[model samples]
Target: MVEGNNSEATKFILLGLIQSPELQALLFGIFLVIYLINVIGNLGLIILIYIISLLHTPMYFFLSNPAFVDLCYTSSVTPNTLVNFLQEVKRIALPACATQLCCFIIFVVCEVYMLSVMTNDRYAAISNPLLYTVIMNRRVCIQMVVSTYLYGFSVGLLQTMLTFHLSFCIINHFCDDIPLVGLACHKTHYKDIKEVILFTLAGFNTLFSLFIILISYIFIVFAILRINSAEGRQKAFSTCASHLTSITIFYGIIIFMYMQPKTRHSLNTDKIASVFYIVVPPRLNPLIYSLRNPEVKNALKRIIEKVFSTVK
Candidate 1:
């Protein structure tokens, strides 16, 4: 193994999801479909929110950020993965790997923070419907969105900086189970620090976001229960149910992908989990939001009708 240096030999081989040519072809086709859906769905949601005046609200405002982030998240991982499936060498240059690591962390962090903000938005709506608008005002919503991006960028920058400073072997492969920090340090002495940083960034961030989301939902549930009318309670819950479903699918897979002990993961299982972690959430977010939320559904119909009219 060669030490990490900025030379012609600084590339690493990526084994990809599978080694067999037949399996690679099958995986590529599946991933291509998933990637296209992720792109269209996320882009459609963002455009739909922007053009539709009726959908302009703090909740949907927060919703737009996730669509944007998920668009970026899937783009970072899926395209490279697709290319790798078709490659004979399966080797990734050091620069490309670094870029992937940077983008992957940034989007992952953005997703967690944005979901937490969505839960908080829900909490505001349920806990005080009268004051929901006031509490989740334009200014507060903007700040929350800004904070999510800043936090995501900060974590990505730190991890990237940490990795690039240290030396690494020439042939290391990119693995979702391993963090950039873990990839850098080859010595046993640094293993403790490496594990700590990896766990702190991947595990702590997710759990922390989940804690905030969980707390917000607890209050949301209490508020719904206190509503005098069954219709009122259902109305309140309908707003949050979509976000809750999204949170469940996203966080569940991400936790399994990054947080669980390595011994628990098998080779095939790991690849499948990673695919769902990176690709499935983005592809699913638009469908979940549109199907569950009335405003988005109506906005989509308007969009389609307008497009057909223009074509006619």
Candidate 2:
């Protein structure tokens, strides 16, 4: 008999997305398709951006970063989630779990800031067309990219260090306790503190980014409305529509996931929200931009024609 505190339930089975076997199989298949699409779509966007000289603009520059971020974001979780679905053992190594958490946090934070940067880029283009180039020069754009990544990495590091410092007692179980930090702990003072910190960081990052976007759009909308020509208003709104769609999807899920009380923790809910960030965004981003942005569409067509001609 294993003697330890009740909290010593070392290895907690994930129950893998759902408890029903048939549902598990179906869900796995669905997610597998989604993951594949996400990979291909994001990769295609990146490749298209690189090859398409016409897409060499500040907006596309910001768009490409998120596409890259989405690839890394989805890869961090979906692959492991797929593996867990297929196997009897759904255990993760302690180090691996920590790494996943860190990477996930990093990319998520980066994406949030990158979206904000994109908003600023749009603001410059729409609100100050004359100075857009001067304001968003190559150096400034590169700085924004670097700042986003560095900020994300720093926050992720701080959270990882804070989380992994807690001790987990051993228990009688087939699985290792270290691997499941969420389940392995009997009690730790830092859990609530760490969670609060994480939530605060997420809130500040998301809300701050969102505030900037909203403010920029408010000015953009004002500028569009002042234009005597209907065509000008339509054009202005059209330019922002795709970014707005992406912003809504991204921040809506983020708010739903992070803005709740700590007592509301549920693995199923977490996994679903995670899917929005990891799977849906990546798959939908290219489609959204390509459908809405004329430049991306033309560039894609040109690239496709060039490739076909080369093959011939």
TM-score of each model, in listed order: 0.91, 0.88
TM-score between candidate 2 and the true structure: 0.88
**Which whole-number lDDT from 0 to 100 does residue 90 have in model 1?**
78
Give the clashing residue pairs of candidate 1, or none: 4-168
- Model number with the top TM-score: 1
Q: Which candidate is the best by lDDT?
A: 1
Residue 283 miss distance in model 2 (angstroms): 1.5
Q: Report the lDDT tens digits of candidate 2 across residue range 162-216.
A: 7666554431111211222344354666666766677788789988999988888
Per-residue error for 241 in candidate 1, Å, reads: 1.1
Worst 10 residues of 1 by lDDT: 171-180
